[model samples]
Target: MSTDLDYLQTVLPAPSARLAGKVVLVSGGGSSGPGWSIGKACCVTLARHGASVCVLDANLDAARDALCAVKALGAQGIALQADVADAAAMERAVQAVMSAYGRIDILQANAGIGKVGGPEDIALADWERIQKVNVDSLLIASRLILPIMSKQGHGSIITVSSVAGMRYLGYPHLAYNVTKAAIIHFARMIAQQYAEQGIRANTVVPGLIDTPRVRNTVAKMFSADDFEQAKAARDRQVPMGRMGTPWEVANAVAFLASDEAAYITGTELVVDGGLIGKYV
Candidate 1:
């Protein structure tokens, strides 16, 4: 018999060896709960397509779990523990990957936090924490990897920014909104600065994703005892009448990480299920 976990861990089919011989380092590369997560999906999807994936997360065990999926795809895998919010830890993580795999070809920055509150309701500490998790972490990863990529003269950086960053989408979390917005511009600037170095940087903006982390956060934000109610409310907000799946976002990450996007850089890929279209 198959369990939900079994279903969630199913390997995505390879689309050929597009990423063969490439090394991919994914930060926050694990699931937050017993279901598909954006980070895990990205790692697995990239691995399925032939990339050797390095799974880095604060939770070493979870990182290992995702590493298993990477290997299941007949891909090489490595697991590393790192607190992305800590600059020193991230630097060490970059070094560790370089030690294990001579060079990194793809950098996936996917770790983030979501807190619900507006300016008046948010506290200084909460705002700072959110910024560190959502914004500073991306900065740390990019700073550490830029020089390495420059020396190699080839690399792709795919960051997971939220659609909330582009505009408000029925959430009151000012900190999450502001920090996510920062991730977009930060990635774009990196793309522009590193274009001559044969490096590419882009942001994947996800909206109303149906992941465990998102479910719990929405429940808390609306004070809804019934998670279903909160979920349906989120569904209604999207023009497509439903929230997106992790696999959908993974597709975007894989495209950017692959050579298919060699000429694509400094652009925003909106995986919002038409939510942003409705907003516009």
Candidate 2:
């Protein structure tokens, strides 16, 4: 008997070279929690599609690992280290990309941090940190890329968000939720203002993905057996009866960044295995 994986692969279309010869900058393109993180998956998928990628991460090692993986796939990649929240640092990073690639065709602002806290118990410093990482970083990076993209008359900016921004997820991460919601609006506003300039911005809001971060967080939230049980239960809540992989999310991002999605802008593509549709 054929396995489910085999059946799925048979039904799903093969990957395409949609972004051939393009230059893409992927921020936070590193491993965060466990398994393949979304940023890492994006870097790999983009490279597989024939793009020369710049892997930017706060963790130098993680950035290097992502670049190495891309290179292993016979694609070109460079690892960059930068704190996305630092305006000057981000500007320099963009300048470096311009120097190396002549021009950037895609910008994936996927860096973010998740912290748990309620409105009454949330610490000021934690709140500030989450906001700075999640929202401020996107602002600074986009600000630096806007002029370059405007001059080129064509570019794509894809931001990673979460369904938590739209509805509750039985968690107390107020700051994370707020920043993610802001990102959706941010992308929409940028799309509206820059469509005339040929720059498109969109948000990829992933649902409960089976990334390392989610797994580790789940482990922390429940006992070992309970964690597994709860995870299975949560997965069953989705219409597909499973959590999505980072590669699935990356595939959506690649499409939005590629010319294939040229006419699509300021839209939120939720890749949640029907979780948002059922719950929200």
Candidate 1 segments whose C-alpha is farther than 4 A from its true place: 1-11, 219-225
Candidate 2 per-residue lDDT, tens place, 1-280, comes to: 1113343344333646788889999999998754478998888888878899999999988888888777766788788899999898888888888889899999999998978888999999999999999999988988888898999999999999999989888768899999999999999999999999999999999998888788888888899879989899879877899999888898899889988899999999999988887765
> On a 0 to 100 scale, what is the lDDT of residue 240 in model 1?
91
Give the runs in model 2 whose Cα sits over 4 Å from its true position. Answer: 1-15
lDDT of 1 by residue, 1-280 (tens): 1123455455455456999999999989988876668998888889878899999999998898888877766689899999899999998888989999889999999998867789898989989988898888887888899989999999999888888898877659799888889899998999999999999999999988888688666666676566778788779888899999988999899999989999999999999889988776
Which is the leading candidate under TM-score?
1
Backbone clashes in model 2, listed as residue pairs: 34-212
How many Å off is the CA of 53 in candidate 1?
A: 0.5
